[model samples]
Target: MFNNIFLLMRQELALSVLVFLLLFIKIGKERSNTSILNFVNIALFVNLIIGICFVGKGELFSGMFATNALIILEKNILNLAVLIISMQSFAWLKNHDQVIEFYLLIFTSLLGMFFLISSGNLLIFYLGLEMSTIPLAAAANFDLSKRKSSEAAMKLILSSAFSSGILLMGISFLYGTSGTLTFSILTAHISNNPLQLFAFILLVSGFAFKIAAVPFHLWTADVYEGAPIAVTSFLSVVSKAAVLFTFVSVLYKVFQPIASTWYLILILLAVVTILIGNLFAIRQDNFKRFLAFSSIAQVGFILIGISGSSVAGSASLIYFILIYVFSNLAAFGVVSLVSALTGKENISDYKGFYKTNPLLSWVLTIALFSLAGVPPTAGFFGKLFLMMAGAAKGNYGLITFAALNMVISFYYYLRVVKAIFMEENEAPIEKLGIPLVSKMAMYICVAGILITGLASMIYDYIYSLSFGL
Candidate 1:
């Protein structure tokens, strides 16, 4: 019984234990100048190492939970994301009284995401989904310094609540029709019944909200502009990646039978998302809001892979997200650091930034260029693979529309680049002094962006992992 529950569930169990351990450390008499964020970073890094060495897969809790190679890989990617976010954020949280509360909120949400990513049963997925969304609300509200923090929290939770209702209703419909919560058996039972079709659309809507897909993305830009940069970064990269993977998993792995229906929906959704995201991005002044729309556009590109409907599509999505993690994090890291030092969050404020902060300027420049799909950046290849995967389906018209949208995206992405390198500022931000840990994290991100593009093996390995290549 111990082995059954503990072996495959090691990461989740260990993370739960760490949260408790953190409680003790927070409350214990020992007090010093040391930051708990630092300690948490170290602990999480160790967790990543342990996860890498963990070999094998199994279902736990009577098959409600699953831990497999793909799940582990996804978890590690998330871990890396959280670690970098934490490291870069120490300066922001160092003096806040709710530092313990901050980390707690993060871990709680992360634990929920772990369950969400690994669950084999619908009930377990819902449980994890709630766990993930709740703490993020609190985290978003952590900054009472500004009224918008509270506003962002309210918007996020309300959206989650509505999505939850839709999702739960859909799950009930599925249960009524299929009579099983286990996904492995779900595909066999699901038919083209109108009831089941409605349930699937409802389920897709719930996930679309989470992934910040177009129609459901009303809350994204405002929340991103209002929330703390660290929280916004977490939402943009980590949360989106998890939702995308889970969306892909359920559709590609479990519900391929209904491909005739949902894939068509995704194509329409993808075109709309790309066009709206890019069009809105052109008008954003707040740097975070710009990134918010940028992320939305990127999601549309990811949809191309999903609509492609092949192992290659799934593999390309995972690979693209890996590249995306490094690129987006690096961009946000620079934003966080600059915001901390100068209290500036507008793109216009970044004028003549290169003269003052070369490292940050270059990192942001490369990151944005990569995001724009410029050659020799991981994002370029990421888009290339996604395009290739989409092309595989012989849908020339859809791919052509996607390609044209990519051109529109380049204009907005380079707008930020133009601010950093070409535009001049009367009062440029001074040379910023980032902490060692933040610098290290930025270096890692920059390196990842470069190497992942220059080396084919990086993409090859990710594709191999997803496809057993």
Candidate 2:
């Protein structure tokens, strides 16, 4: 019983303690804010280690919550994400006056995500979801100097509220019909009735908004453009990935009975998301907006994996998300560095970037290749696994369409690559003196992306997780 309790709340407990300690350091007689951040980082690193070591899979809280390979995987992923967010964004935060408040909000949001990932019931999930989102709106408005930031905050809050309402409506329908909110019980209760079908659609559609999928993705570009780069990266990677993880879990675990039906719906959504994201990405001059659309397209591929609704599919989906975190963060790291140094974000501004800042240019190049699914990067293997998983489900048409779209994606990704490597600007970006922490973050991302691609152990472990279940 003690072991189960330890395993269950270890991550959250560690983080909550760290947050409190950090707050103490901030509000204490010592006016040393840097100490708070440094201590927080060290504490979080320790907490991540605790999560990895305490990994056990079972139910707690009378089965309202559960833990398993998926739960462990997601917690570790979130920990890694939070760590990177802290390290990479720390330099930027130090320059701003609100660093302490910012870190507090980030940790708060991360704590919420921990609960969301562990939730086994709709009630718990909704509680965690709302908890995670409310802080993020404040983070979006952290840049109070910009009107767009406040505008973005409003949009995010409104959209999140709307999505939550839709999700609750779906849950209400499920409860009305099935008389249970627990996913394990729901599988036995759910039937292919028209009301249940509509409920499931509401649920998936609500999550689609969270992940910024097509037809529900209207607010994404504005939010991405207006939020601080750190916040943008957080939203793009952590928030979207967590939502994807939970959404896939609920559907595959509870709604397995309607796999055939949702499969087609997912395929259709995937096609439109890919087409719209890739097509619009080509025309974007703002790098952040470019990433926004590019992310939408990437989510489409993720949908392909989810559509499989099998162990292989979940493995691939999880693997893809891991690499994606590294890839997208690398891109954002470069963009943040360049924007800080030169105030240039347009693709054209990248011309001759390689001449002055080869490291940033190369990092962005590698990230773009990975994003475009080029060979020898983790992104390539990520896409390959997702495709194979989809194909296993007889989703050849959807997979083929995705492949064609990949080719289309390469054109736009390479356009930026060409500007950096091939084109020349009379005034190129100046040389940069990267801080130690930011450089460490970049090296970690680059090494992880390369090693995960080259190493078979990574995929083998993922497949083991899939097969074990």
Candidate 3:
């Protein structure tokens, strides 16, 4: 047992050491921070390579640290998200102080997420959750001059505390009912006990907060509005993906026997989240807040995939997340570029943007259309798979509601496109030159959105990969 723990600890520790080394190099230097950013990016890429090489399916540390193909894929997705986020950060971090510490926090937060996707026990999961979350709150306030940033930090902390408290209570209840905290043991122990049901509700509530499900999503818009665009993109993509991955694992492995109870609850939550998120997003003029609400609606669609609780469901969820990472990153990248150039985040500020920056404007248009489930984009296929997964289980109502929500979502998504192309400008807008690395990252995302749909070979590949899990 000690040897197993040592091995697992060593693997994670190596990544930690790399992160610190980058931090040291960053702070030890003087003057411009561009080199440090470049170094961090290289380090992240190397760490991802190491993670890929170390992909052995096993449980370690008495099942507290588990690694398998599914977890490895999830971690790789997270690494991709981090790389894209770091690229986005370049524009935001120019001339910013404490740049070294910022990169350190980002790496640390990512490490936490890696642990979280592989966590095998409740305690380990909670530890990873907090480790990932606390630094992000600080990151939200990285720009100390802005009062809105500070408010975002406060709201994040408060909401995280509330969710963590509820999670602890849920863990206590589960321990009391099953007399164990290990997931494998819990699967064997869970019965139709009322205590187990209560524990499930509590656990789901904690996940609900993390995923920004309706009624628990009041903080999402404000935080997205207040945080830097890079940070907001991280929250929407990496953080939410971790939570959903863990949620699906728990539901399928630990609580499978109680599907009837949880399924109804999920169905209700999915309906409300889809409806409310779409409705609220329509009124948002702030681009960041609009994306925030759009993310919420996307979560609802993913929930429909999850409700099926099959291997196909899990595959669909993963595929949806992959598509979303590209589409949303593309949207945010364009928004970040616009905001960096014009110092405006409002939708109205984009009037005649196409005339100024046709390349970026078209990128934004494709991203939004994909998000609205228009065909020939990854988003369309993602939604198609999700609806197919739900419908496979004879969930006609879920499919119907999801379809309706997609229609509602189309209006707001197109509104942005209209603002960019159709609306008249009062003044001549200057086109800004984007950094080479940032431009490459955005183009990569755009290509991903376009190609992922055309590649129908992935369906068979996903089926085979998820067969074991």
Colliding pairs, model 1: none
Top candidate when judged by lDDT against the true structure: 1
Model 2 lDDT tens row, 402-452: 999999999999999999999979988779888787888899899878988
Clashing pairs in 3: none
RMSD, candidate 1, Å: 1.5
Worst 10 residues of 1 by lDDT: 460-469
Worst 10 residues of 2 by lDDT: 28-37
lDDT of 3 by residue, 286-333 (tens): 999999999999999999988877778888998888889999999999
TM-score of each: 0.97, 0.97, 0.96
Q: In model 2, which runs have C-alpha deviations exceeding 4 angstroms?
A: 467-469
**In what order do the candidates fall by TM-score, top score first?**
1, 2, 3
* lDDT, each prediction: 0.88, 0.87, 0.85
TM-score of 2: 0.97
